[model samples]
Target chain A: MMQEIRQQTDANAVHRDLTRLPLDTPAQQAEFDAALQANLPREAAVRRQYGMDRRTFLKLMGASLAVAGFGASCTARPPEEKIIPYVQVPEVMVPGRPLFFASTMVLGGVATGVVIETHQGRPTRLDGNAEHPASLGGSSPYLQGAILELYNPERSTTVRRNGAPASWDDFRAELAGLSSANNANIRILTETVTSPTLAAQLVALVEMFPNARLVQYDPVGRDNVRAGGSWLLIRKSTPITVLTKPKSSFPWMRISSLVCRVACATRGTLWPATPCAKMQTRPA
Target chain B: MNQLFRPAANTIARLSLLASLLAGVVILALLLVNDQSPYTRASVGIAIEQPVRFSHKLHSDQLNIECLYCHATAEQSSYGGIPDTHTCMSCHSQIATYSTLLEPVRTSYATGERLVWEKVHDLAEHVYFNHSIHVQAGFACETCHGRVDQMVVAWQAQNMTMDWCLECHWEPEEYIRPVEEVYTFGYEAPEDQVELGMQLVAFHEIDVDRLDSCSICHR
Candidate 1:
């Protein structure tokens, strides 16, 4: 019914276009205003509820008053020189000085540990985990920019359902439905997760679904690394053998009279934090 | 007569409009907070103030209390964890009962709150400096911490930059990895790293071909 009403047009739609014309000059605009003023008495029954009562109408009047009073005794006075009295400076504040503290960040997804530098309350930058698996102890350039991601104003705050704000209860109900439908046969599709407890939880969840199959879908869309490893060893346990430095850092590796790969490989053995290279025989 | 009546009515209407606008502005100012902070630092830096003027001289020299006695966790965690109010209260709870220095500690304890300690020494945001790894590896609290046992008010000793960290690491024997000779305090190395590396190689039968690689440190 509301849609149908919106589709219909008012009898005054034709005359409304006349008032909508953008008069460029103040004189023309004033004439238009005068014409509007002339019609006000006719529309007074409906116009009293809005228009003059609208803040926009008041603003229009205020602007016009400012323009009208531009000269004569109404000439603008110079803005008040607001001498904001200074507040007492706290003894602790030294304007240019910043203090740093060491903080830890959990590595998400494929990355290893990262140490963060916190200045005041703001996380300023990421350093290598220095002692964690995956990254070994070194940080990649990609990991360095995580502080921006942490403080990004545009990051999503809450989950949404369709276009509506979803409540925790509503989400739980959806999950419950999914659980029942699977009926002791559920599959949690994930990559090569090395977490033992998580695998156990997945098995427990599968017990709920009658025939749920946990399909392994590598998010990288590659499966060469997915050929099941023996229970004795995990793939992640092996350190990166050919830890190649970023090309910019080691251009000599590509074009040198003396090839630099062996130096890079040997350097990894000596230094833990630089470009740690592994045997080239291993697939990167 | 018409002109005189029109101007009077217009003036009254316009005055009413201005009054309404002024009222709206006041309402908005009440609704919003002024976001601009005069100081970029936190709470005008008041939150970062030291609880007491803890002297390294009186504790480290006069009483011979080890630097680690006060900042006990420096050798264990990423944070040389600042002693909580309770740690201060352990002694101050009785020893300095009447002193003005212990007043804040007592007040914090009575209120069931923690001390908000102002840190003096700081490191860079991009560097992941470890306390335990360095401590366990036999680096003194002073090497990177810069002679805190001698400081009156523990201030940052090292500039703690990438170059400084790398400089120390580059010559591991001088500043790092060589624990036996660095600390004058006679802190012994738990395991000789070079000897351990050798023994592990021999026992595990790990050839140079199968050892921890560069990915261990620089990811």
Candidate 2:
């Protein structure tokens, strides 16, 4: 295995003409031959003394079998390409034929309701995934068509190291550095998280790194909630709310699409329906 | 220095020099090819192999067991689904109760453990999955799901994604609902799409005009 791996490595590593050797001079060949001869087994050397007689015997025995089996495979050239085309790829392959699967799913938002679909897998057309309780079998198109956003290909691939490839060790080292910093000085920001376990872990990390701090920023802030969540500690507590509009990790605008109106905090407030209107072009 | 010590030291130094030279040459060649020094994390951590060997075709074709008996909730639940240990226990407890094929399951029950069945379909984090709706709406557990009774150890037969899913929903009748013959492991008409589309349009009062809107799903 080691020899095979070395051969592969040499094959891959040497891209130039290898037949013309830089080191295999006549003297070097003679030296290699002498070294090889010195290492040959004594039994093999004795067998060589018997010379062509034994070879002739083995050659006669091998010829009969080789002649019999060679007939079928002699002229076979491998086809240019081999394709195991699916024997029956479903006649549903017809262009006009549309097949649908009714699977239930959730529509993410302030409401975050369940929905059903009368969709193909793409939601080329939509109906809710009706059986789920939240949608109550009736669905709006927003929840029905969300499947399109899932496959948009623009999702972030979790790249790190300022766009350079990075090792998990590098990530761990950076995180360790951040944790080692003063909790009050280090800021870890996130949207309102639902998992209790995650919340507990965050609290533990916060206590461990007293100098480390957290900053929560919502793109679309619920007027009163954002005001309160932000001011609680501009330097400490994780500011989170349902409609302060969590920062979604979706690469396209679709990530934020799931965030609903801040009806709880905005009922009587002056903020517009779409919060994008509220963000300043540049921070003052 | 003595002759013995000097000769040994010279060989050691020469071998080290050769090894270092080869290492440097390899590293330099990689650098020229723009090869990264560090490899990336490209996959997840947890992967477990299944215990039993089961064939879908044998159960589905030979015994004629329905897909839903094992799957149970392909159309009615959020999980297209995996039968709970009890469900497996229900039948195996009586039929084929003593077989080694069912022995591992017995071990799980004795230990109060869940047999780690490897999941075949892995959906994107963004999409939702449900089974009850499909089952209740007159779809056989076999249609979009593929045959399960035929499988001993369940394997994913279809690519489950948003596009493949939506295409199934747009006109379900083609892939679904022959009514009398619910389990379809065989061929059907290719034009069933338009036929099913028209049937769905009539069956459910969906306005075809607004079907393609992103808000139908994105929200």
TM-score (chain B) for candidate 2 is: 0.62
- Tens digits of per-residue lDDT for model 1, B1-219: 112244577899999899989966864563332212212111221222355777775777666776565555555455555555666677776786888877767777788655555544444334455575666665566566555556666555554444566654544434443444333333444456566535533443434432234342234
Question: lDDT of each model, Cα atoms only?
Answer: 0.51, 0.50
Model 1 regions lying over 4 Å from their true place: A1-284, B1-49, B176-219
Q: Alpha-carbon error at A97 in model 2, in Å?
A: 33
Q: Candidate 1 docking: what grade?
A: incorrect
| Global local distance difference test of model 1 | 0.51
Worst 10 residues of 2 chain B by lDDT: B36-45
Best by TM-score: 2
How many times do residue backbones clash in model 1? Answer: 22
What DockQ would you assign to candidate 1? 0.02
Top of the candidates by DockQ: 2
Candidate 2 lDDT for residue B205: 52
Off by over 4 Å in 2: A1-284, B1-49, B147-153, B169-182, B190-193, B206-211, B215-219
- Across all models, the iRMS values in order are 17.9, 19.7
